[model samples]
Target chain A: MIKVQQPEPYDPLSQVPLVPPPGHYSASKLERVLRKGLFAVTAELNPPDSADPRDVLKAAEPLVEVADAINATDASGANCHMSSMAICSLLSRAGQGSVFQISCRDRNRIAIQGDVLGVAALGVGNVLCLSGDGVGVGDQPGAKAVFDFDAISLLRTLKTMRNEGVFLSGRKLTTPPNIFLGAAANPCIQPLEWRAERLAKKVTAGADFIQTNYIFDVDVFEKFMETLRKEGLHKKVFILAGVGPLASAKAARWMRTNVPGIHIPDRVVDRLEKADNPGEEGKKLCIELVRQMRQIEGVAGVHIMAYRREHMVNEIIEASGVLADRQ
Target chain B: MYAVRLFCTRHARAFESVYKGLEKVFLSLHPLLKGIGYNRLERPVAMIEQMSKGFLFDCKMCGQCVLSSAGMSCPMNCPKNIRNGPCGGVRDGGFCEVRPEMRCVWVEAWNGAKTMQNGLERIRVVQPPVNRELKGSSSWLRIIREKGAMKEASKRQLDPAKSELAQAFAKARKLEPAAVPLAKEPVAALAEQAVKEQTSVHSTQETTSQ
Candidate 1:
């Protein structure tokens, strides 16, 4: 079994870097597991809407043990919450590794580049670059959408800082951030033939790995993987298939209608409706997806996004048994 | 206007050829434009450009126009103003998540690119962020100036043994001794080179590890 370590003592003001083992891009355990050719699992932490540090700790306590790394989202859905940097700071202070997500919808290049150095100093090793949801989808519709950089440009900028030791403006840095860069993809979206090409663009822009939007249709997802294989992208980066548990058929239907990129097949919702207890059935479906994803040729792991259902992640991972063979 | 914009993308090749012809006209008129003073003509030229391109492509005049590279569809019209490519939130049926009534700009760009001579390849370029300072300016004039500068540089390179006045003027301006070749390189070629460099870096790391 993979061993869980106790939190080490840390000073919040320190800017010292965590030294990775030789040949690794980061000190992240997720990178270590993936590099060692073992199935890795990552989970998203629902940022609490409160200022209390205890709330952040409570939400992350369960995930720290099960997830290879915890992801702190940056104002996902354009709804304001505890800032992702604060959540990652709390996790890092507690000696836990976290993925610091940066969305380009709210910050310009200057603000974002500064935050990268801040997170890196605080011991964050993985960074997820996203274009973020448009501000119109949020509680506040009047906010400005400052997409100074899209996901591809964001990835490219971060990669330049890490490797070339310079910012986008060619300014030299005293010490560059050591990061494992990642980008988001939606494989089940429209104009299906062009999805893989878009992913290829992201890869060329400096994405070391990819986490897709929620996948409820294995058939369509398999087709996406086939395209990646044909382009030989699978050899260049790790691909993590995103899966989530539904609360009920009504909730699934609502998501399919309201959420921007989510695609829930009609049969899956019908099966959830036919079940005696839809909540329990949703967990079963998620576990089944994990098993099936593990068998896919190019899939490196599964990213579970159990929003508001964080408690079920432990049970879902245990039941899926992806880490059963690890020691 | 929307239908007309769609028509322009459908006939992107025709528009491209038209732009090439217009570029030649602008090039030939450079001496006259300089004589008239570009600063004095800026407002009138900008007004004319806005009147025409606005009617045709609903152009926002971001001033660094990439209409030819983007399949003749204006990227500034995207709700997010994403210049690189489509955001992940494009809805089913290829509609905009933010503006469901309208189709995704990148999707139209892709379709328009398919009919062009090199549209598919050109569309793959990762565009840099828009320069907010260039808003409401005339991209046509800017393109003409850039092309004129390129031509002047090439002429100087070929006839280095020819003009002392032009050479002295270039020295006074503190320009680079030679213009960067990147100004004339295809963006897609640079993107491919970046991918190759990344793969070579990975292979070198593997060799050292072994």
Candidate 2:
């Protein structure tokens, strides 16, 4: 019998250092923000549909100081907006803190490591690695999806790059990115316990922090936090629970039904439906969620995904009192 | 899609436990089976299973069946053949990189992970690259052998009883079985040959009811 060997496990992060080394690179500002014991607030910058850089600034204008740092989304919802790196480069230069998001859907490891260095050079302090929403969910469902590394594996690879000061090829880097690694979680996704266990895995993979999907269902989000706390992962990583405003009852219902990993309880929808001004009521509900999420023990901060409603983000953040605890 | 129901998924926790139980049962039989002569039926049965599954699910026979984990479609059907997730090359409207006409399998997997109760947890586990060793062989026997090896390794090495059993297995693996004659070509050609052989065999399997 010809004994054919089983394929060796193809771990991209194998042979890399298991733990981070001290003084490897400069630390990111968001890391300081979370470590300070002050509640941190992060908001996403909805890139303008046009190439105008001013549009990016204008979108970011309302979020300045109001948010500790703004996440520049990378082709979120599998739709093209201005590139997250481009906007983040501009934002970082403008002296506003930007958390650059790197989606594995777009690049291989070589390009991803290059982009990580590029963003660090641009003064972007933090990066959120995401296994982005499928292309079918976007305007162009015909695009090829390139998920080179899912969220967890990307975190591991990036951590190796920063700590080891070497590429995946074993070649040394003159300078590693002085950056904080982040990953995404969706607490409301089905098989609720799996979500928390995956969070523990990301933590094991060397994720310094996490930002979750929208928190319409804080009950579920709380349960997810409870699981993390039980696993002792809450101490190992910072979790910024996701919160977003609903434009109306219709928008809430649409998001609940169409979006993956988003759960909107019927009571919230009915509350929006019964309100005289559902738009304002939606913001109120979102504000309430932030307040509620802040009270959760493991939640270190909040990530506000306002979508197209970036202008109202400041009000939501202030009303939620996420920054009120800040020094 | 129908193949998915008949094989994996749709069973949830029931499927995982049954799969583990099958491995345990197979491992327990290894010592007894080592004494018997090589059975010719095993190879033919495995070949038929592979061919039928390949035909039905467009199976790459990744040897690791993620069909239930990835809806009914084969993730290997993706042009890039990424096991863990999708790439950005997925065209707008869920098009594939290599074949633009079809939906990307990983994209379908993401959608499935969200909707399917049985498949939801499988999405988070990172799958390894394709095992070439499993390509031409029966995954059933391979799974059994792999489980037996794992069981042996996990046992305390100081146990003299286990050492004797280990020696027996090593001896059994070293022994020569009667040789079967076939073309010494590559796997692709052998697979093609098997298909032809199967077709001829089935051709005579016509209706006797009439």
| Candidate 1 chain A: 10-residue stretch with minimal lDDT | A1-10
Q: How many backbone clashes does candidate 2 have?
A: 23
| RMSD values, in order shown | 11.3, 14.0
* lDDT tens digits, residue span A1-327, model 1: 345553464454664578777988887777887888888788899999898999999998777777878899999999999988888888888888788999999999999999999888877878999999999888898999998888987887788788878776667799899889999989988878788988888887788888888999999999999999998998889998999999999999998887778899999999999999999999999999999999999899888899999998888888898888675
**Using DockQ as the measure, which candidate wins?**
1
lDDT of 2 by residue, A1-327 (tens): 111112122222333211123532334556776786667778888887898999998999878757777899998877789999898878865767778998776777668879988887766778998867667767898988776556765776677677777664546689787788888887775545345756765776668889988877777777778888888888888889888889988998887655545667888899999999998998898888888888899888889899878888888877766675553
**Model 2 segments beyond 4 Å from truth?**
A1-26, B1-6, B9-210
Give residue B106's error in model 2 in angstroms.
11
lDDT of 1: 0.80
TM-score of A-chain in each prediction?
Answer: 0.97, 0.90
Candidate with best TM-score: 1
List the global CA lDDT of all models. 0.80, 0.65
